[model samples]
Target: MDKKKVSSWLESELKGYTLKSSQDDFVNFLIKQADKIDKEDHLLLKDLAIDWINSEQKDLTTWGMTIAVEYNIQEATPSIEKLLGKVKEGKLWTLYYLWYIDGFLKRIKEKKE
Candidate 1:
């Protein structure tokens, strides 16, 4: 999986981040990296997603969902679904974030077809 390469790329890409716009490139790059890694590495990607979400960086949070979608990390699906339910129940204020995750989940499901 070349974890070192992924870590190095992420560290370099995330340096001096200023705005969400800058994250687009980073997100795409990470997706490509995930594609190259072994499927068994899904746990690593899942952990990365959780870390980004917990970091509270809005853009990174979106990127995490992107990773989950790209890799089909089923382990994250329950958490994302729960969060979506909370958002729908008005227990969370981040509507856009939840919506994005919900959309990602739908996309993943569609891809399985």
Candidate 2:
């Protein structure tokens, strides 16, 4: 995966902003691009998702959590938990993100059992 290319497309297509109407569309589009994901992509996504989660911007944070959730990046769970405690916005959508992540992970565990 070309990090630069993906970065460019993300910035250009979404303008680094998550509009309410297009939010689900972008997330769904990314989920459909399973062919593009690999080990390197996973690592890149983990890093980027964590960075976005750490950011103060709500939209960036949403994108971060969305990617984490869609890609099954449980690595970001700790950061999301931390954000929930460290930031004011954490009480909002952050709560749902954490819930979704925790639920998703639990389901994965259940399926494996």
Candidate 3:
């Protein structure tokens, strides 16, 4: 994939900082940038959902959950749900296996809390 193009696309979609970096860096930048958005910019949250959760990079899925946890705590539940859907279907990323498991455990723990 064209990392630069993707980065630029993310920068535009995010609408705050101009993004100019490699795809990995851009992904991190987008995650960090999401923290800067005011709560009023709910659109940015949705953009983050599309960019991070639906990113082609499997690593971004975890990063998306991380950002969702940091920026929107309520989103953590839905993020785990999305990850669980992937795990159940056996399409979960090998690298993110533990992250997904931990998220599931976290959800269960929250329920018992």
Candidate 4:
């Protein structure tokens, strides 16, 4: 994570990736990024998640939910149910995004303990 501008590149990718962009390219890339993040990176992802959860685009919303689940981002808590409803109403495959919503709340509850 220390390749100077490399983080920006990652941020750019995360920010700009679209569902049509290589078909699941963002999800595929996030699979690698999911565990490598530290506090600063988590914070960055949190900020991104805020907007992503609010996004109308299912791909962005799902990716935001993925980051929220992986990182336990509390800030995203408020939007979880609402975002789930939106994604569920979208294309069927986007329903795959709903998978992580289960763990997200469970982990948040655990964190409170």
Q: What's the alpha carbon RMSD for model 1? A: 4.4
Q: What is the Å distance of residue 72 in model 1 from its true position?
A: 1.4
Q: After superposition, which runs of candidate 3 have C-alpha atoms over 4 Å from their true positions? A: 1-32, 73-76, 95-101, 104-113
lDDT of 4 by residue, 1-113 (tens): 44335445555666665664673676667756654554447665577766776765665666766777666687787787666666678843367767766566566556656
Error of 3 at 91 (Å): 2.3
Per-residue alpha-carbon lDDT of model 1 for 9-99, expressed as tens digits? Answer: 6545655444447667767666665554435576666777656544445666566667777766666666567667777777765676676
User: How many clashes show up in model 1?
Assistant: 0
Candidate 1's TM-score = 0.60
Better of 1 and 3 by TM-score: 1
Instruction: Please provide TM-scores, in order, for all candidate models, with all chains considered together.
Output: 0.60, 0.58, 0.48, 0.51
Candidate 4 or 2, higher TM-score: 2
**Model 3, 1-113: lDDT tens per residue?**
34345445545664554555565665577666655552436556545644666563655555555555545545446556666667666786654575564674475446545
Off by over 4 Å in 1: 1-12, 15-26, 33-42, 51-57
Candidate 3 colliding pairs: none
Error in Å for residue 16 of model 2: 7.4
Clashing pairs in 2: none
- Candidate order (TM-score): 1, 2, 4, 3
Cα lDDT of model 1 overall? 0.63
Per-residue lDDT over 27-77 for candidate 2, one digit per residue giving the tens place of the 0 to 100 score = 765554432544447776677767777774676666666667666676777
Q: lDDT scores for all predictions?
A: 0.63, 0.60, 0.56, 0.64
